[model samples]
Target: MRKNSMKNMRINEEVHRELSNIIRSEIKDPRINPMTSVVAVEVAPDLKSAKAYISVLGDEKSQKDTLAGLTSAEGYIRRELAKSVNLRNTPQIRFIMDQSIEYGVNMSKMIDDVCEQDESKAKSREE
Candidate 1:
């Protein structure tokens, strides 16, 4: 498959789906929480490497635990992914913690606070 080809996109999606399933159903590591989710997947042009972005809905400790579980289960996850996708070469899986969701929420809260303050200031000025 060419770099960034349609096939690559499809492969990324497939990997993402299969990896999520594998993580959810197959792996039984205690470190991994059920709240974990696959946020995104990025595959290399050669299809030899895949990075899975995972979001853990908990504190920092739980997030670290989930990542640790994923990191240790990389071999099994890759094997399952290959079998599930029927790929000639199984891409090495890498787990990364994704915090974009939390960041967005925090940013939204800050914007709301600023807006409320601005409205109060405007009201005071009018008064």
Candidate 2:
């Protein structure tokens, strides 16, 4: 299957949804923060391997710990995936730390600060 083929896209979406559900409700590792989320998932067209992008809403330590927990539980997760999704071959999952959400929040805060500062300066000038 081609990378962006309709079938491939459907597979990716199904995998992404199932992964989110599995992480949210199945895993009970303490190292994984409750605030952890599966941001995205990419399954290879051949379905031999996959990459799961995870985002943790916590400190650096928590993020690292969550990633480690997920890494260690790969086999279990893969098994669960196989059970839940009827695919010819279940992809081997690789956990990846995704910082895009955090980066976007930080950038938003900075923009708001700048806007506030600009407004304050305008008010002062008007006084």
Candidate 3:
């Protein structure tokens, strides 16, 4: 199947949803922060492997610990995914830390700060 085929896209979405559910509810690892979320999932066209982009809402240490925990639980997660989604081959999940959400939040805050500064300067000039 082609990489961007409809079937492949469906598979990717299904896997992404299931992975999010599994991570949010199934895993019991202490190191994983409660605020952790699956940002996105990319399954290979051949279904041989997948990349799960994880986002943790916490400090750097928490994020690192969460990734380590997920890495160690890869086998279990794969097994769960297999049971939840019927597929010929359950893709090997590679946990990747996604920083896009955090980056966007920081950018938004910076923009707000700049806007506030500009408004304050305008008010001062008006005075």
Candidate 4:
């Protein structure tokens, strides 16, 4: 059997926490929704770049606007990170919208509708 070696998950978790704090407190962009959360962070082995998955609790337009705001404020975010974390090079931050939450909500609704239909059919059969 072969074992797979991977980058440190703790590093990724630390980065996610620090980035989330920087965005919420340091970044003064009003376009960003307060409800925005950092869902996950993936850092390359070389640590040159990081992709941040964000979940926004709002409509599609708000999510799009929030992403745009984050993209434009990337430089400021990176600078703030330098003061907090010591690294040879600050990884570039990329914001991506996470739709799993929305997908799960839709799937739950579909399942509820199917259950209601089954109950209605059962009642009619009894009548």
lDDT (Cα, 0-100) at 109 in candidate 4: 100
Candidate 4 lDDT by residue in tens digits, 2-78? 11124346557778999999878877889999999999988765668888999898999999999999999999888
**TM-scores of all models?**
0.87, 0.98, 0.98, 0.86
Candidate 2's displacement at residue 123, Å, is 0.7
Cα shift from native, residue 15, model 2 (Å): 0.8
lDDT of 3 at 12: 92
User: Which residue pairs collide, candidate 1?
Assistant: none
Clashing residue pairs, candidate 3? none
Q: Which ten-residue region of model 2 has the weakest summed lDDT? A: 1-10
Q: Which ten residues in a row have the lowest lDDT in candidate 1?
A: 80-89
TM-score winner between candidates 1 and 2: 2
**Candidate 3: what lDDT?**
0.96
Q: lDDT per prediction? A: 0.89, 0.94, 0.96, 0.85
Total clashes in model 3, counting residue pairs 3 or more apart in sequence or in different chains: 0
Show model 3 residue runs off by greater than 4 Å.
Answer: none
Q: Candidate 1 versus the native: TM-score?
A: 0.87
**Top-lDDT structure, candidate number:** 3
- Give me the displacement of residue 113 in model 1, in angstroms: 1.7
RMSD of 1: 1.8
**What is the full ranking by lDDT, best candidate first?**
3, 2, 1, 4
